[model samples]
Target chain A: MKIAVDAMGGDFAPRAIVEGVLLAASELPSDAQIVLIGREDSIREIFKEHNFESSVVEVVHAEEVIEMGEHPTKALSQKPNSSIGVGFKLLKEKAIDIFCSAGNTGAMHVGALFSIKAIEGILRPAIAGYVPQLDGSIAIMLDIGANADCKPEVLAQFGEIGSLYAQYTFQIERPRVALMNIGEEEQKGSLVAQATYPHLKANKRIHFIGNIEGKDLFTNKADVIVTDGFTGNILFKLGESLYEITKQRGIQDDFIDKTNYESIGGSPIIGVNGNVMIAHGISSPTAIKNMIGWAYKQVQANAYLHIAQALA
Target chain B: MKIAVDAMGGDFAPRAIVEGVLLAASELPSDAQIVLIGREDSIREIFKEHNFESSVVEVVHAEEVIEMGEHPTKALSQKPNSSIGVGFKLLKEKAIDIFCSAGNTGAMHVGALFSIKAIEGILRPAIAGYVPQLDGSIAIMLDIGANADCKPEVLAQFGEIGSLYAQYTFQIERPRVALMNIGEEEQKGSLVAQATYPHLKANKRIHFIGNIEGKDLFTNKADVIVTDGFTGNILFKLGESLYEITKQRGIQDDFIDKTNYESIGGSPIIGVNGNVMIAHGISSPTAIKNMIGWAYKQVQANAYLHIAQALA
Candidate 1:
């Protein structure tokens, strides 16, 4: 299996990306190959600094670069030779099994939506965030920053998508899926939430556990929580900042440690036609290594196939 | 000023509520009066336990009690003799300047909407929450759980309401108002966010600062942040639970101390005819005391009058 990585993306590009790819390559299966997609000369220079064998990794040159601040759709279209633009091309042609980037989030999202496109019959692809539960377990929350305004049917579809990711990614059996609402009672929540309740209840694809409030975000209430992008994104960033606040205050604890975004490196853009992964822009070498490892696990598990069959 | 206390409300009803009232009474101005609305017998018993002066506190008989679990609208209407019911009646009659309860949130909300009603010309009454900034200053956020689905006009009105409260209460001069969206760019965010952007920008009544994202929530970006109730409620509860999570981990820090709900006690329900406050259901005696104190400040500031004039 071959994996294509955007070496020109992220704050610590080329250098950190090269080292992380080397680390992942050394530990990966013997048959697995790494294709570094970026400016060829810069990537080769970093690899030579460590004196690593050039035969183990392949270099695919990308002439243009997409700055983090550029508009995603415009940047992708304007720079076909950009690392992100070329990476998507490799993934589409089946030259690589996975395409991972730690660069611009909006760029990655747009690339996923228009390039490979969402899975057949899917309304919109969702981005899932890792939630550290109090009980030492982790839960998956989806649509964190995509589909900000969602209909009831879209929320119902997200339930199946979130459940599939949880089962294959975390190996949770029949993952208990819950909709994030203001109250646990079915009658409670906004009009959108109220309309989505019945659809989630009747959704036979996943174990529907009804509504879960914001207070239950880090609890053992449910393994998969589905929400629209607007609320989910706010909750996601709030939790992330809370972790930062606790850290800044010199509060040392194990659970608080899990809140660190570095530990989970990146999140998978599930429901997409092909394997696509997004890492934080500030990812370090260790984070990039973990992101590659996570992508490898997804490929091995055939998670995309499971989701397609579930939706089908 | 006369304040009506729901002595029968809160998790520690009668006992904690009565004790908190006594604390507020002693520290309040010489002209202040405390009217305890609950079971006449139980309230007198709590006052007797403290050997407090009966002359400073008055008890109004309320035979029925609204359970925390009961439906909000149904319980408020069905139980007219309930403490919450009697408190609202006194507020409506102008017999009391303020009414506060920590018993049930929904009940407090329903009672406020039905009894005193919203100030005329106000699109919707917005309930604001306090956010503890990293700089030790506090920011007021509006529509936390009310008006889950808001049109562009409602959001504009909320900006003015929040600005007035911040001016009179916190004494912020020309408080900077900002719209909460997915991105800081003017064109960023969902359709509703897009629509609300121009309205907030054109709202000459407020000092609009365009948009702020999830990352700027606790930062010093804006003093008054406006968003629809659905997203605000989720972020509010998520922030509240973060305080709980840090506390459970036993992480002692001054910043985390601000996250404690007890410090603020209750959040004043803005855009209403009369002053009203609601505390957490599990509020202790200390939280209750703080709730009463906050209500007193709002009454002193004539916050309601300022809001009405601003809208006019």
Candidate 2:
């Protein structure tokens, strides 16, 4: 199986990406290979500087580069040879088992939708964030920043799809799904949240655990936390910021350490046709390496296929 | 100044409330007095149990109690002699300097509206939460859990009223007001949030700062953080939970310690005609004591009068 890395992505692209790929190469199984997609010369230069040589890592040249600030749909069409563009092409063709990037989040999201596309019967594909739990486990929170304004039906669908992803990927049978809201009551929340609660409760595919308040975020209350992209994105980022806030104060704890973005590295765009993970824009070498590890696990889980099958 | 509290409110009512009042009575200024509103016998019994005696503490009898789960409007009308009802009556008649409760949040909000009513020109009154800042100061976040779904106008007004409250109550001149959003960009949020941006920016009364994400919650980015009640309530509760999660893990930090709900105690309802504050239903004696302290500060600040003057 081939795992593609966008070498010309993120703030410290090429160097950080290449160095991270090299780090991941050492842990990869014999059946797996890392495909570095970018300008071949730049990737080789980084490898040479690190005094690194690996038979498991291969470079695929892409002439054009999509800058971090470029518009998603426009850049994908205009710069077809861009690293992100080519990476999606390879993913669509199944040349790579999974595609991971720390590039422009919008471009990556747009590229995935335009390439492999959303799975059949999917209303809207969502970005799923990994929330570290107090019990050393992780919960999957969907629509992190994908659809900022989702309807009630859309949010309810997230609960269903997110449950499937968590069950198959994380191996949690009948994963407990909860709606992220202001209160624990079904009737308490914004109009959209209030309306979505019943839909989630009515769904028989997953274990609906009712509403989970903000205080229950890291308490291992549920396996899948579903919300619209707007609230989910803010909460996810806030959760990630805890690691930096605590670290700056010279405070250390086992659970707090996992809050670091580098621990999980990437958030998968679930409900899509194939495996696609998007990392932080400021992702470091360690973060990239960790992302690749998760990428390998996602490839193994084949959650997208399960979602498609369930929907079908 | 006379500060009134609902002794029959909260999970540990009468006992915790009376004990807390005694705690505050010792520290209150000579001119200030504590008016305990509930069954006079129950309060005196707790005061007797604690071996506490103070000239500053007085008791007022209210025959009925508003349970935590009771409907706000229904309970207030049916139980006219309830603690919350008597407290609001005292506040309306100017018999008390300020009224605070840890009971039925909805009743307190509804009572304030029905009694003192909202300040003239105010579309809606909001519950303002005190967010602990990294710099050891506090930022005022409005609409914590008052109106779940706020229109753009209501949210924009929160920014203005919140700014005024922060400036006068916190004694900050020209407080920086910011919109709480998913992203830092103006156009990047839900439909209501996007529409509210331009309104906040155009308001001449506030020192409007751009968007502040959830990560910026305690970063001292702004003095007044504005958002709809749904998002604001969840974020506030989430921020408060950090203290407990960290404490359970035996992690200690000066900054994280401030995240404790007991640190400040109560969240004040802004845009109301009178000074009204509410605490957690599970408030302990320490929390009640601290809330009384803030109640004293609120009376001194006279923030409600200032907001009324500004709108006029």
Candidate 3:
């Protein structure tokens, strides 16, 4: 199995990316190979700086780079030789089992849709975030920033798709799926949520646990938390901010520590045809290293295949 | 100034309500008075338990009690003699400078609309929550749980009214107003947010600071945080939960401590003709006591009159 990473992504670029890949290479399974896609010379220089040499690492040269501010469609089309473009090409051709990047988020999202594409029955592919629960577990929250505006049907399907991902990937049997809402009552919420509740309830695909409030976010209330990207993104980012806000005040707690974006490193774009993860633009070497760990688990879970099969 | 309170409200009801009033009576100004509306006997019994007697505390008989789960409109009309019903009646007749309760939130919101009505030219009355900023100051967030669904115009108006309220009530001149969105860019966020952006920006009534993300929530980025009720309620509750979640783990921080619901006690109904506050249903004595402090400040600020004059 091969895991492809974009070396010319993120703020730190080739240095942080290559250093992270090297960190992952030390613990790599014999069957797994790390594929670094970017300027070959730049990656080699970073590898040499750390005196790291590994047979498990391979570099594929790409001439162009996609900056963080570049428009997704425009950049991908104009720079087919960019690292993101090349990484997607490898994943599409079955050369890599998974593709991970901390680069232009829009570019990575657009590249995935343009390359492997969404699963046949998927209405929309969502970006799923990992929320650190108080019980030392993680809950999968979908549509973190993908579909900002979601119809009732789209939201209900998020419940179905998110449940399947959690059940297969996280190995939670009949994973409890809950709608992110203001009130726990079925009738309470925005018009979309009110309309979506019935659809989720009628659907036999997921174990609908009714609505969960904002206070229930880290309470280990549900395995799969579903909402439109707007609410989900704000809530997820607020949860992530706990770490930095508390740390700046010289305060520390075990649960708040997990709220750090570095702990998870990346968020997966679910409902797509294959494994694709997008990390923070400010991702450090440690964040990249942790993202690689998740990438390996995602490859092993192969939940996309399960999602496709279930829909079929 | 006559400050009326519903003693037959909240989970603890007359006991906590009477006790909290007793606690506030000690600090009550010579010219200010607390009018407790509920079963007079029940209230006096609790006051006796505390060995408290004060000229500042007065009780009005309210024969009926509205349960927490009762329908707002229906309960108000049917239970005309309920504590909440009597409190609103007093507010409507200008018998009290302000009315406060920890009863059913729906009931309080509906009662405000039915009695004092919304301020002229106001699109809607929103529940404004006090968000504790990391800087030790408080920012006012609007539409916490009033209207579940709000049009773009309603959201933009929240920014204007919130700004006015913060300026006059919090005594901040030219308070920075911001829209709560998924991204800082004006073009980003859900369809409603995208449409609402231009309205807030164009409104000359406010000092618009553009979009603020969830991470900017406690960072004191804006004095007035504007959002639709659905998103605002979820985010506010999530912020409030930080207190309990950390408290259970034996993790304590002064900043996190302020996130406690008891710190400020109650959320005020903004854009209404009168000053009205709705506290948490499970409000304790300390919470009620703190809420009274805010109620006193709200009356002194007289922000409603300012908003009414501005809209006129």
Candidate 1 lDDT by residue in tens digits, B176-275: 8998887778887778898999988887878999988777888878899898888887777777776677677776677667767887778778888988
lDDT score for residue B221 of model 2: 96
Q: Write the per-residue lDDT of candidate 3 for residues A177-278, one digit (tens) a residue.
A: 999999989899999999999999999878999999999999999999999999999999999999998899887888899999999899999999999999
Candidate 3, CAPRI quality class derived from DockQ: high
Superposed model 3: Cα runs more than 4 Å off? none
Q: lDDT tens digits, residues A138-234, model 1? A: 8888888877889999988889988988888888989999999877889878899999999999877789999998888997899989998888877
lDDT of 2: 0.92
- Across residues A182-296, which tens digit of lDDT does each residue of candidate 2 receive? 8888899999999999999899888999999888889999999998888888888889989989989999888988989999999999989999999998889899999999898
What is the per-residue lDDT of model 3 for residues B1-312, given as tens digits with 9 covering 90 to 100?
Answer: 998999999999988888888888888777789999999899988888888887899999999999999999999999999999999999999999999999999999999999999999999999999999999888999899998889999999999889888988899989999999998988999999999999999998889999999999999999999999999999999999999998998878898899999989999999999999999999999999999999999999999999999999
Chain B TM, cand. 1: 0.94
Q: List all candidate RMSDs to the true structure.
A: 2.1, 0.8, 0.9
TM-score of each: 0.95, 0.99, 0.99
Clashing pairs in 2: none
- Scanning candidate 2 chain B in windows of ten residues, the lowest lDDT window is B14-23
Candidates 1 and 3 compared by DockQ, better number: 3
